[model samples]
Target: MINKYNNSNKDVKYLYKNFLNIGQVGLLDKFDFSEDKIVQAKKCTLYTESGREILDLTSGFGTQNLGYNNDKIISERIAFANNNELPFSRLFFNEDVAKLAKKISSMLPGSLQYSFFSNSGAEANEGALKLAFKYHNGQRKLLIHNKDSFHGKLIATSQITNSPEVYFDFQSSLETDCIDLSNTDLLEEKVLKNKDNIYAIIIEPFSASLARPIDFKTLLKIQEICNREDIVLIFDEVYSGFFRTSNLFYFMNESDLLPDIVTYSKSFGGGISSVSGYTTKEKVFTKAYGSQKDALLHSSTYSNYVEESRVALKALSIFSNTNFQEEINQKRKYFIKKIHEITNLKYVESLTGDGFHWGIGFEKIKLLNLDKLLKLLPLEITKDPRFAEKLYVSSIINELYRKYNILSYAGFNSEIKLFISPPIIISEQEIDHAVESIIKTVEKKPLVLMTSFVQNYLLRFLNKN
Candidate 1:
């Protein structure tokens, strides 16, 4: 086989050059072309140039629950595609879509039986919001979202998202009435006072911004309030779904509370291109878009993309299997124990998360050098809010690439939290390596040695060049 990173390959060189020119490197811009480029992936690992192996901890932003290039899912998709299946069958029903919908609905708890397929997480959230408004006849106008929750990037989802920077350019179109996620009392008051005017109240079961897990009791209470006031409760489980949080669904495992509408996406496709449908009670669907004319109210051209749906169907099967859940729980317990043991690190103020998703909050860490790293990153990567924290993580990633070649992203912004959601197929040894890398990075005072050692290295590199 030809070399993976052969500079002679004009296609690869052209792509890399274009990436450097137009990429909007954001968040701590640390990743660059000079680094190893991954050309193939398998299980929980990526294969880069020079045969370097990088363990994936972020799981492509938590979409690869089962891990990269799952063999079974790939086989299923290939089988579907080999049959010359049409991807877009407008207004026509396909068996794979029906079967996938049935499988997803079967896995969910309660009367969440209806499924509306979409191509992305944002589309799923948008569908959910539209469903909520249609169900309540648009009389209920306000939708409540948590302060640090990330829904999606569509116009509606962007509005509900609490990040000022993400929605900075789209201020005019963003929603104006989202409440602070922590203040439950205010949420209750708003729901009670605006029952007639409120369409739905959406929340991330696990708060991504604070890296805090919502209390089960609080979630239950929110459900109770929504129920009492006839407001629709929507759980944006795009990030916390499909065993990422130690359960089949975060809402199902975290609490007994049920929401009127629940949206899922990430990890559903098993790292494939597919998105997912939102589940809701039969009544909600009937009340919202009961007629044929209303069917088009929330449909996507890629709603039933054949290959993506096939992968999703297989992925759902993998997650629903009992053995996978048992294995994941065992691994989760061990991982949490190891994190707790690293209590002496000064930067680690607290560690919080459940299932496969978790975060580490840093107290104080100067981030100038981290900023320099960010300036070097490519632009396709989303800008994280926790810049300092991300910079620290990028440093660790860079070191790992230099030595062990492990690659992972710093989730959120500069808040000192490293978002981790390794693939379900990750080995114990891989987890140990990740933990060791993180602990070593946190304990070592790289910033302190910057003036003497780090600066000298930079100066030497500049002189040599």
Candidate 2:
């Protein structure tokens, strides 16, 4: 049985040991959080084993959009538990699953009327890939993916991802073409060059790592190209989905382009269950898996999990409310303003992103002879290399957690950006406190920042060993 522990140092050691045993030692060392035990989370604040309160700006990497321990959503889960509902089998029809499917299909704007439920963003992308490939009758040879776009870590998605350094060992079986979505000329050139062999062009409207919206003209141009080439256009909205982007979907209120397929997972389950899905048009579905024999072809045990389905349905209902969206918008405006205030600091390069999702980027100050030292590192250390930007971002993340008790994320792109994805329900007071804490965190003495860098370097050295 899982029981809460009030022990501080002892619990931390046990957790670290278990993390090491699970091969997550490097991940734990990388962040180097000041406090290692979180016993409970209430709304936007996390409570430690010692009963210290820490603001959770990470929002579980944007999954806890509605915040933790949400009573309303939890009540739904309690009801399901009381009913003692059995897990739905793939071979049989489930009313709750069918209701959720209809609700999702009808809720999506535009022509996206079909959806396939799964357990993760990666699984959803896997489903999307299978559909895209099958729709073309298996003749299309290449998938055009954008730079800095993170679709998933699965086989097909990993191959198409631009962040090869992060997935060095998990190599892709199929060849893929890459293009920078920010450069319109380069994007058109690559797409047109590989249009004949391309099955689909997948991208995020605003990639979380890049932390900026893609130019609308570029999206329109890609859409036009995909239309002319008969290639499916897919949007990986796993991170940018829900009202996280100030829009229901990033492509909804922001752009006029309608993608053939869209995948979402992060916030869709209301932070209560593991659920994800991909939406597509009826024609695309018909072409891909319309026949009776093919209907059950792409499925897994967790595809129709009843508990997750019920929670997802409730979450969708919550997201559909207009009043809740307006309240989120109100909070988002204040959140952006508070973040903007911190950008005035000398170390801060800029703040980028939309709505409640933003990243704080630091000014890049080159270290002398760093590249030479990096070159001398072992081949295994060099294989899935971490760049200067990622290290700098990691330092900032560590400093924030250590000094201010605010959890944040570090971007992995060429320019490291510290990400904040606080719950939309966070109050203006909480926002002010977080901003003030960050201001102090960023304004730390040069010696403090240097120590953070040293800690990071030592961790990397340990990783190398």
Question: C-alpha displacement of 79 in model 2, angstroms?
Answer: 1.1
What's the lDDT for all of these models?
0.72, 0.79
Over the stretch 74-191, how does candidate 2's per-residue lDDT look in tens digits?
9999998998887676667789888988888887777898889999998999899889988998898788788877887788777777774355757567667777866768867776
lDDT of 2 at 109: 76
Query: Could you say which candidate leads in TM-score?
Result: 2
lDDT of 1 by residue, 1-465 (tens): 135555643355456557764343322223432344577888888876656777887788888888888888888878877888777677676888889889988888888898887878888888888898889887766777877677877777777777644656555453347777567798877766765787778898876555567878889888887888887899988878887776777778644778898888888887875677788999999888889888778776677776688788888888888888788878888877776765668767778887666777666555655556445444444274444445455555555555556666555532446666688677778888888877776676656422332343345445645
True-structure RMSD, every candidate: 4.1, 4.0
In model 2, the Cα lDDT at residue 22 comes to 42
Q: What is the TM-score of each candidate against the true structure?
A: 0.88, 0.89
Give the worst 10-residue stretch by lDDT in candidate 2. Answer: 376-385
Candidate 2 Cα outliers beyond 4 Å, as residue runs: 1-23, 30-35, 368-391, 452-465
> Per-residue error at 366 for model 1, in Å?
5.0
Off by over 4 Å in 1: 1-29, 32-34, 164-176, 366-390, 448-465
